[model samples]
Target: MKQVLVLGAHGQIAQIVTKNLLAEDVQQKLFLRSSARLTVANPQKEKLIEGNALSLFDLQQAMEGVDIVYANLAGNVVESAKNVIAAMKAKGVKRLIWISTLGIYDEVPGEYGKWNHEQLDGGYLETYAEAAQLIEDSDLDYTIIRPAWLDNQDEVSYELTRKGEAFKGTEVSRKSIADLVTKIIGEPSLYVRESLGVNKPNTDGNKPAWYR
Candidate 1:
């Protein structure tokens, strides 16, 4: 049985992933800055640890006895990834599933390219790109998932692009992203050392439709 540690467990996508993990009978450990952020029902039943991801001591403590690390974190993501890498190395945890964004690699095409770059260039894209690079270059077994603009739609459907491939469509559901994360957890070998771009098929447009 794989023991999964979810960083940023209160994030929308991470919450969905946690529910799915519970259903699959996997051991779960949740790390968040505060217990108040956890809205998941019966959070106390899981191994919920309160700590900052940027702190190595906190991460070291939370990562104990963990098999896989699912990083669905935001804000200073680059620094967070570095800490995760170091902590995982110390803990001897080998698998990492990292959540990233499409625009970080300039993979979107046509007008959407302009829009994505303009929207994320100075802030999110730069930080995410740096984080992605760090993860890819690390010795740990890692899969970097780049999902398009996240939506709250309940359906779990999506498309994928391999590393260096042009991203497809836009506006994948948060459920879809969670499903992918769940799948990766179940099969650690799948997409290892790979970066995937996930989006909704047939939803291609200049920017996500929701932004219009």
Candidate 2:
């Protein structure tokens, strides 16, 4: 059984992933800034640890004996990515699934691309891009997931586009990303060392449906 460590465990998708993994055979260590935010329902399959991603020491301590790291983080992400990489190296753990936003690579084309920039440029997109580049430059097996505009729908329906391809659709359910993460955790060999763009099928528009 692989020992998985989840950083940013308080995130919506991470919480969903935790619920999904509970049914599986893997063990999970959920690391959050305030561990009190989450409860561990299964003592055998799950452990909740308090740690900040910006602290390399905290990360190294949390990463001990872990095989896979799923980082679903936001804010000061570049520093966090650096700390995660360094800590993972210290603990000799590979295999990372990094959650990043779409438009980081300017991969969304046409009017939606322009609109995305209007929504994310100046700071968010640039920082996420830098963080992803740092991850790419690292030697560890990493799969960076760039999710299109996310909704809280209960459905799991998504498509994937690889790096260098124009991104598809305008939005995807957060549950879809969770499903993909769970799938990757089940078979760690899938999509290794690649960046994936995730979105729902045939939802293309100048903006997401809700936004329109």
Candidate 3:
């Protein structure tokens, strides 16, 4: 069984990913900033490790004996990604599955996309894009999955495309993103070093229904 370490185990996407990981038969290690903030009950508690994703010390501690690192960290994406890369390098962890957003590429051409760009002119998505660029230039084995407009729906169906291509959809379910993350963990060779945008298929106005 592969020993996997997950960062940002408390966020919405992280929570879904954590649930799926725990249900699997693999050995999973969760790294969180605080245990008090986690309200989810894990019957198998031994796999969970509490640690801050932003702290080098905590990251180093969590990186030990891990085969892959699944980073879903939030806030200051550029700085956080830098720290994560450093920690992974120090511990000789070779695989990273990074969670990013679709608007980072500015490919979604329309009023909504324009609004999104305006809103994130100086926000986390900009930082996320910078971090993604760093990952693109790094030597580490990485796959960046950028999902569009996440929703709380229950389904896990979606389509994926390469960078610079329009997503054509929006508001993918959190469950689908989690499924994608799990799929990456299981099959790292499929899209290594490639950044892909994921979304539901568009059925109207050449754009996906979710976007409308």
Candidate 4:
């Protein structure tokens, strides 16, 4: 079984990814600052390692013997990403699946894009942008998954786009992002070193309806 380490295991997307990985019968080690609020009813199937995403020492410990690293950490993205990269370097781990947000590239346009900018003011989005750049510059084989506005409703289904193209939609479900992560884990070669945007297809409006 492949040993996978997931950072930010308490978040919505992370939670869904955890469940999907378990369903795949993969051995998962979750690293979080606090696991008390995480109600994973099945303890026997998954391993929980309590640790902060900012702590390199904690991350190093959690990454031991892990084959893949899935990072879903939020806030101070650059710092946290640096820590993850450092840990991966020390452990000689090569593959990483990073969860980033859309608009990091200013690819989402118009009114919805304006709203996104407002929501991510004070350079929060820039932080993620810098983190993505770091991943691009790193030697590790990395797949950056940038998803559209996140929603909690329904199942996994969405469209994906490569860099330079606009991510033409809105509100992908957390479950859908989780499904993408699971798929990436199983097929690591599919998106290596690629930064892709994921969104639900928009069939209305002159432009992508979902973006507006």
Which prediction has the highest TM-score against the true structure? 2
After superposition on all CA atoms, what RMSD does each candidate show versus the true structure? Answer: 1.4, 0.7, 2.4, 2.4
lDDT of 2 by residue, 1-212 (tens): 88999999999999999999999999999999998899998999999999899999999999988999999999999999999999999999999999999998899999999999999999899999999999999999999999999999989999999999999999999999999999999899999999999999999999999985
Model 4, residue pairs in steric clash: none
Query: Model 4 lDDT vs. the true structure?
Result: 0.84
Judge candidate 3 against the unseen true structure and give its global Cα lDDT, from 0 to 1: 0.79
What are the lDDT figures for the candidates, one per model? Answer: 0.90, 0.96, 0.79, 0.84
Count: clashes, candidate 4: 0
Question: Which of the predicted structures, 2 or 3, would earn the higher lDDT when compared with the native?
Answer: 2
Order of all candidates by lDDT, from best down to worst? 2, 1, 4, 3
Give candidate 3's error at residue 35 in angstroms.
Answer: 0.9
- Off by more than 4 A, model 4: 203-212
Q: What are the per-residue Cα lDDT tens digits for candidate 3 across 42-103?
A: 64533667887678888888889988888888877787788889998999998999998878
Task: Give candidate 3 regions above 4 Å deviation.
Answer: 39-46, 203-212
Q: After superposition, how far is residue 93 of candidate 1 from its true place, in Å?
A: 0.6
Q: How far out, in Å, is residue 32 in model 2?
A: 0.4
Candidate 1 structure, TM-score to reference: 0.96
Q: Can you give the lDDT of residue 202 in candidate 4?
A: 67
Candidate 1, superposed: residue stretches over 4 Å from native: 39-45
Ranking by TM-score: 2, 1, 4, 3
In angstroms, give how far residue 49 of model 2 lies from its true place: 0.6
lDDT winner between 1 and 3, please give it.
1
